[model samples]
Target: MLKKSLLLFSAACASASAESVSVYFGNGCFFDQQHTMVTRFEKLLLKRSGSDVTSVSAYAGGDSSSSDLCYHNEGEVEDYGKLGHAEVVELFIPDDKSLKDAAKVFFEDFTQLAPGQWTRQDVFDLGPEYRALVGIPGGVSGPYYSAIVEANSEVHNLNLKEGQGGDDDTIDTGVVWVMDSLKFPAYQAEVCLQFSDDNPAFSEPYSEKYHSLRDALFEEGTLRNTTCPTNYIC
Candidate 1:
């Protein structure tokens, strides 16, 4: 009887170990701009991990109102789309190996956006500030195509203003670079990630690298930290 009970307990543990990991991607207002990037990122993650990543989903309603840093009492509730500051992308992994593999891919792919890749001189001019905003370590030269790299960097000392008492005078410094030229209007892209579980195995290095990218992007002025009262947009 004891042998049979032990077998049942071990089976239950094994089943639990095989539980699925769900990944979710949320995009606030800039859904269209973020779609292609997210798609590319997702494909890369799947390819690198060689794990069973089940599906990818998008939500269009905008970030949750309660978390907005610029929240106002009289603001029109219908403007949810305009008020949202960030978008999200999520993935689910079936096991630990899959999760770790996906994370490794994420780090590798993101690091490739360094300043050395810009091909145009005009865009290259703005690379430093872009790097500063996104917290990239060095500078690059060439064209604006590298702006994506800048936008993928970081923002530092994010301070939120609430009511009249909070620090309002501080115009939180971030990297900003102009991309518009003789032919085109200036544009920028920002990317960020949020994980559901606090798995220590996944959080540490991922967070560090993410912060580096955030600094680089913010330094370049392509990404801004709009996380309000809460440190997260969603």
Candidate 2:
């Protein structure tokens, strides 16, 4: 099990000039075989949120240690039957965006893959649309996600495994967007998806990465709600 570290914080503050933000992705069966999946997630997050976003896995919803960060992988038995799972990511936006707007950017970009068969190439193709929101703006770049070497490396390694399919193989998946700011201590909101027969993606630990990916896609199209269930700790 990975030990808990101090919850990551962004250097930018949610003041008049800059903002600190965090988005928690929930209800996908992230498994041991999917280490690459998680790694890719972090890379995309860092690219979209900025070069400094911090991402971590956690047992959110209703695990005994839900408040504490939990290791996300096949080896963690406690995560097997839990209500759901979560990935906490912190982002720093300077001057131009609000945490709320950043959250919307994430929702919009991710939802593109919610339905139909989309590839990472599709994500890359949306670079222009995401440039103002996530990119360096006006800066000449070879690739959209070329800000960090680690992210580039992970993207490169994604091809190391052959024959694995896209996100169509997983089960139900969804995400709840909650933002807390030091500037506004009382501010909090929950944005989650409503589950249905066709789109049943809520966060959970998976035995394999493929299962998790499908569910993760399911979550993108679901509706957002203000409330989290008793079983869920959002």
Candidate 3:
């Protein structure tokens, strides 16, 4: 549905230095009807990662006519299930941080990082759109990439399968998939779904503008309006 790159790499790269990088991941169960639960998790991601990161519920890691896709609130069908896209979170990591900061949160945040609470067979099934995966754009090699590969492998107690890919790469951790983001791209999700319960101040200027744009894009109550803010910002 969306036809854009995961991150505006060309423009972002041009403007910011290497210290400030945007890394994206399909972190499972991007959507939640429970407003309090969503905000609590958002705060956790911001706090534990130890970064003032901006995030969104996004779609990625499946074939499409184009790389970009959108999340539709499906009652019978799961979000983006028809398109085979995975529910993901696109995080904007601020200056002086590396991919590992994001990686730490991805691997350590929850007991099980896979998407959705119930499996597909359950009547309450949230579907398979929730898959745990990490993406790094540009095929860029350095300490940051190595850190991701290393942490991912360590979490799974895996050894590097050399000649397969990166020296420390794991194709599938039996639970997580690690790959270059360009392979299966990500883009912004629906606008009303942008920041959800978190305040725009937490996510920089984009959140404020996204709320307005979300209003323009969807009709009232079409998408759940962001609930009351629990905290000002993390």
Instruction: Tell me the tens digit of each residue's lDDT in model 2 across 1-234.
Output: 122122322122322133333323222222221222233443343342222223222223222233232232344433313323232222333322332233333333233244532222122222111111111211123121223223323332111111111112111122121211121011011222111111123224433443343344224421122223322432
- 10 residues in a row with least lDDT, candidate 1: 130-139
Which regions of candidate 2 are displaced past 4 Å?
1-21, 26-51, 57-59, 66-77, 80-83, 87-96, 110-234
Clashes of each: 47, 14, 0
Which one is best on TM-score? 3
TM-score of each: 0.26, 0.29, 0.52
- For residues 83-119, write the lDDT of model 3, one tens digit per residue: 6666567654543234554565566433422532211
Question: Candidate order by lDDT, highest to lowest?
Answer: 3, 1, 2
TM-score of 3: 0.52
Across residues 1-234, which tens digit of lDDT does each residue of candidate 1 receive? 111111112322332335643322221222221232233444454442112222221211122223222322244332322433222233344454544443333323221123433221112222111111110111123232243342233211121111111111111122222111111111112133222222233223333432343344334432344433322233
User: Which lDDT values do the candidates have, in the order given?
Assistant: 0.26, 0.26, 0.43
The best-first sequence of candidates by TM-score reads: 3, 2, 1
RMSD of each: 19.3, 16.7, 10.6
* Local lDDT at 145 for model 2: 25
lDDT (C-alpha) at residue 120 in model 1: 14
For residue 14, model 2's alpha carbon misses the true position, in angstroms, by 13
